[model samples]
Target: ISFNAIDSALSSLKNCQSYINSGMDVATQVALDLVESFNDEEDVNNMEKVMLEYATMDRELNHYIKAFEETINQVKREKPENLPDLENLAQEKFLEMESKNSDLDFQRNEKYMYFKDQLKEMKKQYHGNDTIEEIDEDIAVTRSQMNFICPITQMTMKRPVRNKVCGHTYEEDAILEMIQTQKQKKKNVRCPKMGCSHVDVKGSDLVPDEALKRVIDSQKKQ
Candidate 1:
């Protein structure tokens, strides 16, 4: 039978006990007397068998009651008045993560810009006098300094991807495309002259002056 039916039966049996003790319910007294006689009899039935059944039922009833009580307590704990809105909590956490990401972006950009400016200045000062070897060495040093800044986002790259063609690596796709694409049909488009032998750094490398000029031209034409 169902738990509710069993519970109801047990309750009724308890009520019957009161009536039996008062000697008011003849029916309940007869039933009780018959059960007691089983224990008193020498050969009718074993008392141990009845006691084992009672113990097993009692344990099962205890488990059901404990389970029901736990469920009620859990419901109370999860009520609107007691618990916070999970969606709102998740939104707040997301905003917190975004703020942290933004802060990192800002700091990274600052460092990257500083190094880029320094490299540009060095390039301008040493323009056109050195042999291929010296120029390559200087370019290598400048590009190495750029490692401090992210090439794509102009932030300090946490995980930087280097360009196979040009030695210059950036985190942004726009910059990389500009560097890889030839500025004009006449000028040779290639990765940075850092002796890296990168054929074409289209992936994430910053576009050189040639690509920028072509972009400007394309924009003008449009």
Candidate 2:
């Protein structure tokens, strides 16, 4: 259960990071869009203010991600008996990440008001001038092809399950069957990966890795 909590925390952290990166990218593009609308000194000053706000938010998000990573690493090193305490710590960090996300949203809204006002003024000045052309900044993100493969079956994973203890991933049915087989022989269930340190793994040690599943689905579509 503690390992599951740790995995949950890790997933949350990754999600938060993805959000922060996307938000910052959008913020930067918005600033660029504003800058392209006019060349006036006042407009540039307003754009700088908006960019500064985003920069502050970016820094905060980076700090939070770093702190969360450190915390997870520390917890991973702790003994299995200490897992309950680790779960509590993970929950606290998740809450803190949510709070930071809220703070970033507030800052974004506040800065946007100034940005909107500046845009309005710019429109007045360049009413009939050539409109700014929208730049196509949508670059496709490339993922590792290996991520779609199941470590156990060495094929594309359907219904992927992530191992909470060692962060390895596998096909859900394959891992469950492995657990059951071990149980029937009255032996402890351990990770099948050679040289993997994880031991005494149970059915509860696995969780659905939704992110990986999404990636697999997307790749299939393409």
Candidate closest to the true structure, highest TM-score: 2
TM-score per model over all chains: 0.22, 0.36
Poorest stretch of ten by lDDT in candidate 2: 135-144
Give the Cα RMSD of candidate 1. Answer: 36.9
The top-ranked prediction according to lDDT is: 2
Q: Can you write out model 2's per-residue Cα lDDT over 87-133, one digit (the tens) per residue?
A: 45655775676565653354344334333333432333343333222
- lDDT by residue (2-109, candidate 1, tens digit) is 236535655665664444234322322232334323323332123223433333333334334444444444445665555544335544544444444432332233
36 in model 2: Cα distance from truth in Å? 28
Pairs clashing in candidate 2?
none
